[model samples]
Target: MPLLNSPRRMSHSLRALAWLLRYPDDEMRAALPALSEALHDERALIAGRLVELDDLIDRLAHAPALRAESDYVELFDRGRRTALHLFEHVHGDSRERGQAMVDLAQTYERAGLLLAPGELPDYLPVVLEFASTQPQAEAREFLRETAHIVRALFTALLERRSAYASVAAAVLDLAGERCDKVTLPEEPSLDESWAEPEAFGGCSTQGQSRPGQPQPIRVVRPQPAATRSAA
Candidate 1:
């Protein structure tokens, strides 16, 4: 069967996943109803994965705000394995990673989407947000390019038995791919990795404009002053 590729539907899926991946502050909890509504219209495309995410969101909505935030930090921020920055898997502090980041930021700019200061282009949510702006076929092709990264994240989350794994699974589903089991490297100690200054070294500021630094503005060069209309 052909895969689901509704641009509007996929956008909702991406938005929901983006919200879910962020730190679950009170704002996130409060937005659960609207988020739920966004997904409700796309149930058929998402299949059971929608239920899985809705259930997870339901729990987050009812849980104490602080507990929800703590769990998010514990699962995503405390470890590198489940990190949502896609290039971390492929580039890992290499110079190539920096180039890839620049390329992706340029891609977004070409689409007229400017990222906020301090945002990383490889961050899954940001990528999804970019995909959400594309046409259906274009979005799917864009997503397929990163499908492997999503698969890897799904594997790590499943191993940890995290509910957030469902969010990753949903991403694969939207990309029209199945999650495959893969052997992942041993995870380093969270404390050690966090303590290292180089942990986020390469391409760390790829999409960010530093505070007080002039943000790169996109300018369109004026067309050669309209060919002189010599009467």
Candidate 2:
């Protein structure tokens, strides 16, 4: 199987694993390292998206909301966690970059720019500042090695998107599940359904709480109804 294929499988698995981990599933906890490999794929995918998005941000520089800073932060945090996970699982111990990745991920949470659209000029500097603080020697080396892998992945995704007729016909000739083409939604939106109680146990949002950051645990509160007046 392709190396890229593993990440796609893992991404689907991790989404489910992230939700499962919240509720003290011991078996799942034991399985997290294996699950985290899914994130390795996710990180690679995000890196590709980042390269595209960085250029896209420059091209679509019309307004702040055009490419939300929150989206950048979200994508960064997800990739950061996966990177940290790879570090820990591989090292089997803590190290500066692993901790730094966690720290940066948490620092991002503290900023909390998801809902509020802010000026890109204002936030881009902040992102650059954070990036500058990263272990560039390490991250740059890793990025250089993975650049081609990510490019191939994105190329596959683009082909899957644009030349679906030819792609589908080619895949259909192979005589399997037809390798159905996966298309993204016309308008993608965050899954707020996780906000519902059953979906997320405490905090509805995805991703792990940055260590030492305040976690938002939902508390049920009742509000008084308006009293009926003369009809």
Candidate 3:
């Protein structure tokens, strides 16, 4: 009943899940064999959860790459319910989200993991990648702290009847928790209750400065003379 306690095995499992959660590009299709092998290596550590992930991986591995890519986009990109960014479940687009991102980025930096530009710190794949570098106890504690978010995502995926739900379920299993009693976010269907409108009710001009409201300043770094010439 203890979760995967072996650091190396846990790392392999986390990395495998992380890889699966990423955009399903041709590169991902090509890596399926290696990912399957890694998952197999950690099979005993993951126990029964391996079956779900293995089946999902096998399906993706053999499917047309474009189809798999489309499925990934539909499940993850188009809906907030199954969004892979963890903080979206927590802080959303609020100022707290910005601070949490900064904190998480600093944590990764402390562990010698620097994220690429445009990569958010709370992305589930990025979080797993960071966990893969940690010691077993540390990684387990980290997952435990984020287990609520994982449980919420698991529930959302299950509601959507997604095979990728297995990945979230596996993370909860490893965290030694059940998905019960978690008050999940009310994620309405985007096509119905959550559609974007053409314009706001109050705002008329797109970028006009309003009285008493501070306008955001754009900060542009100076480019090298050579780069400037090319631009």
Candidate 4:
């Protein structure tokens, strides 16, 4: 809602944003701006979507009883898109964004619809790192990957709804299972302390022991005296 300019508005926005922040599907992302606009202008696309959504809700009322394919599919598709769009929209600063994605994906699965596995993508962290760096090329590539993933997910749903459950499960298993074993360094004794060689002014020399190694010994050398000239 207009980004919460007033204290009251801000409070309202924060609460609403908190709720919206939890969704991360394409529809939610697409719909949020419209939703906000609708709140302001009343004649916004958001109002239109909301009206459509209401109609869908009406269809849902009889669901599995009346069982109209077109009505149900339309409602389901709109709901799905709205969920996704909201997730994407709040994702910018919403702490609940990731959790929302997980919940939304699971919700679809629970409803007997095949959907993508909800495990956070590995590329997500990489893209976040790239975003923090703000490199133009990296940002563009990250956005591209995000769009591809979104498209792939929807395509899977629309084309292979029947195959979705199995595929989503597989994807989740692969994403959640750890493939690499983590090797932890042995803990050091309290008596153990790091030391360095004085020969190199307490710095490591070439081919010295690697990190986590105890310090090396320093060698002592005697100073040479100037020689007196012999007559």
Candidate 5:
């Protein structure tokens, strides 16, 4: 089933940016025209940056389906450097990352941005979805705070000459941050060497509360006490 990107947030540009970074399944490919329009309509990105994004969109839209999907997996899922789970860059697999995930989820919930089941709060795409719900300046500030991780990802993508780097560049532009190159220390790909101590639970957000539909509140008055006494 296609991921339900049910209407929740308001910022079209940020939402479009998030979708661009998502796995380009058939549904995502179909949205290419709308995503492109959103990018241009919002005017959040510069003309040069827009051109760069267009390059990525073209590849995704026209490339062989398997090649596009496989390439996306190869580039992002294979390594931590390009991982879309943002907290990994900051907290790695440490305990602090768990706390960060919970805090971030709470932030999203407070703003009425409920995550789909199994969605991680720290996932960059989900973060953008939350940001999309906020006021423009507030959303930019949120992005700005994570600028370092994003810039690093951008640098890594640029170094690889990946077209997806444009999406990252556009994120920095939206955040009003400069993408300075950084030499990230080399890390082995998971396929090459899996990390020790696999995660016991899932994402930290697994601990976050999931409130369901409201239930009726029964009000039993003094009649209950009288009935009990009679019994």
Candidate 6:
């Protein structure tokens, strides 16, 4: 399913990569072949990079369904280090992240796409979907803008020896960013990830509490401080 070597061929790699990063539900697991086809057909990733992605695909496809799902939850839902939410890496829980979330969602609306309920705009899969809908150059630029976050995730995944690192590497290749080994500092626990800044109010994230429970991110905004001094 190799793509025709035309300069103008719209690459579906962005969406494919997004699919690779999603929660491995039954539907997604069944789409393995199509997902693999798109990655090769797009020809956006080099052969070496394709090999890495193929390896990840094989691991995910071959693992038991529950094992695959649990593994994904453990790897991505454990801490902020491997967070799929891009803003977590860039802005943590500051007020700026909220505004960025709004701006990104508005951008999606302007492009005629609406997010499903419970979807966050900065989620890697959602961001990639938006990029996939854009013109080729625009899509590349979109990936380029987020390459720093993508690369950090890559390093974090690599540290844990997760197959997901391959997907992040492919993303880096697509963005024309360098994909080399990097050392990321340790990731904090869910409680530690919620540290409040001295200047701004804090944000809190709730991760999985029990084994096999999928990690879902919820941002808790602090109550506003009273502006009046002892009136």
Model 2 TM-score, 2 decimals? 0.21
Two-way lDDT contest, 1 vs 3, winner: 3
Residue 116 in model 3: lDDT: 95
Model 3 CA deviation exceeding 4 Å by range: 1-8, 179-183, 189-231
> What would the per-residue lDDT of candidate 6 be over residues 100-171, giving only the tens digit for each residue?
999999999999999999999999999988988998778877888888889899999998998899888887
Cα lDDT of model 3 by residue, 1-231, tens digit: 445453345788888889999898988878988987888887634556777888889889888888988889888887776889988887766567889999999999999889999999999999988988898778878888899888888888888888888889877766666645356657767785454534543233223445445556599999999999999
lDDT of 2 by residue, 1-231 (tens): 122332222223224222221222345344444434543444423443323333432322332442443433343233322221223222322354456545545665555532224312112223323322334333233333323322332334454342112211211211112223343223213354222334444333233455446666689675545433322
lDDT by residue (1-231, candidate 5, tens digit) is 111222323388789989999998999999999999988887666678889889999999999999999999999887889889998887877678999999999998898778899999988889888888888778878988889999899988988899999888878877777757888988775765464433433323333323343333578565687788998
The digit string of per-residue lDDT tens for model 4 on 133-220 reads: 3333333333443443334333444343422222222222212221121222333332432333466543443236544566667897
TM-score of each: 0.79, 0.21, 0.79, 0.20, 0.78, 0.79
Worst 10 residues of 4 by lDDT: 1-10
Model 6 error, position 99 (Å): 0.7
Each model's lDDT comes to 0.79, 0.32, 0.79, 0.34, 0.81, 0.82
Q: Score residue 167 of candidate 2 by CA lDDT.
A: 18
Candidate 4: where are CA atoms >4 Å away? 1-142, 160-231
Q: Which stretches of candidate 5 lie over 4 Å from their true place?
A: 1-10, 189-231
In model 1, how large is the Cα lDDT of residue 54?
81
Candidate 1 residue-wise lDDT, 20-110, digit = tens = 8888887878888887778777563455677788888888988888888888888887676788889988777657889999999999999
Native-to-model Cα distance after best TM-score fit, residue 174 in candidate 6, in Å: 0.9
TM-score of 3: 0.79
RMSD of each: 12.1, 19.6, 7.9, 21.2, 12.2, 10.3
Q: What lDDT score is found at residue 227 in candidate 1? A: 48
